[model samples]
Target: MLVKDIMQDIGETKKKDTRFTNRLIPFHDVCSVSSGDIDNAIKSAGKEYLKDGSQAAGQKFMGVVKIRNNNTVNKESIINSIGDIFTKNHTVDLNDPDFTIIVEVFRNVCIVSVLTDYIKLRKFNIFGLFSGGFAEPKKSIHKDP
Candidate 1:
């Protein structure tokens, strides 16, 4: 995978050679849908990733990160809607979640996936990876819905 190779190169060389690429997000599903259908799209795409009963039994923390390229979509509403899809046993932990739900909206298209170690990966920003700056855990004011 190109992403894996780039990440491996970054780790091995510690050199900042990337340009033009901002973030590398691997998605499980993608669909062309209106803002109104975002919730259903995410639900369908993320069902398998969120349905792990064994992991939920341990009360894993989950966080949602929504990136909207257009002004038509409400970011908070999307995040909350995705949060509701997770099992009740999962708690909200924005700073250091066990899993992160990514909702990337570009006009009428939406890409959805669940990822682990999102924070540690510098939110998948290639530039951030070479900066040697780590994301310090922050206190979250976000409550579980």
Candidate 2:
């Protein structure tokens, strides 16, 4: 619901003669979760993304999945499973895509999105993702005024 609200807000603010039929989306998770639920959640989210009419004409899209606080679901396995759901014509264009999907799997839920822009991705820091968990926070150098 929040994603839809945010999309509507962005569409209204952009003031562009554009349709949301094909635009990249970013996802945020806020649902209840349980063991072995990632697969279903992902499938459901993917369907929602498609139903939103966000997939571009060519089905050329990019994606990034984040898993936090999950211990059982393997990212590779999820990717493989999800990949199969797409049409055979689907292709991943990492460098430049008609749209991008961001999948965030948190402790209690999973979220999949088709982002409208890549701006939000600039803040994603790979250095923060560690083997066990997010990398420890580094000390800030700037002092509060």
Candidate 3:
């Protein structure tokens, strides 16, 4: 251990932020949807969740209008892609929502659900997911001994 090692770096946790054993880290840059992708994602979110096979609505493709990136386990970027589906005029009342569509473009996986208020959720298939993620068989991951 060197003397410099003991010195703290910027944003390092201090005594105030600690909560028992877990040190409360000052919020760091999160992996949320980039500003550019927000508009289409939100809009896509709304339409995909609405009635089945609802093609992209005519709602103007306004870019991601709002960004509230925080520490959500599932990166907001993934959600934002679907979020882009919403229009500004569209009302999204979390309490009693019409529908909630989750589009994972990366894996070409879309989960659609008609909302019974935001709390209750059930899944249905909408558009065929076009995204794809890396696939590896367990055997391929490691060579047999």
Candidate 4:
């Protein structure tokens, strides 16, 4: 099965849970490619993402691209390569981004995908959740008067 199909299936399954509202889908076109072609693959994927954006001016938004290097290619080299591409051709925001692009590189091939619409996961405040910043609603028990 295609990676897209797998992602869609996972999204559908996750939607059954009430907590998950936004279904983050990875926009991918080509499935596999050589490790050396990472930059081209990302560029193609980014362009496709821009084309799909309905808003005029191709939807002005910020995002960061990451590479998960599981192959022989040095991780630093991958980071630098992706960083150069972004700096030279695209604008990215690290603090708050509308989306995230990830490239998972294996020995023979790599996968590129754009991710967005993480409403629930984004809103979660780890510090607050751990520090009791949110409280559960209390139920009142009534006694016969």
Maximum-TM-score candidate: 1
- Look at candidate 2 and give me any clashing residue pairs: 24-114, 24-115, 24-116, 25-114, 25-115, 26-115
Error of 4 at 97 (Å): 0.9
**Over the stretch 60-89, how does candidate 2's per-residue lDDT look in tens digits?**
556666789988566776566556655443
Candidate 4 local lDDT, 1-64, one digit each (tens) = 2433434344444422224333333546444545457767777766644443333222222333
Model 2 ranges off by over 4 Å: 1-55, 119-145
Candidate order, lDDT descending: 1, 2, 4, 3
* TM values, all candidates: 0.73, 0.50, 0.26, 0.47
lDDT of model 1 at position 16: 65
Point out the worst 10-residue segment of candidate 1 by lDDT. 54-63
Best by lDDT: 1
Residue 25, candidate 4: C-alpha displacement in angstroms: 7.1
Predicted structure 1: clash tally = 0
Q: Can you rank all candidates by TM-score, best first? A: 1, 2, 4, 3
Q: Which stretches in model 4 have alpha-carbon errors above 4 Å?
A: 1-35, 48-69, 118-145
Candidate 4 has an lDDT of: 0.46
Which residue runs of candidate 1 sit more than 4 Å off their true CA positions?
A: 1-5, 16-19, 35-37, 65-71, 133-145
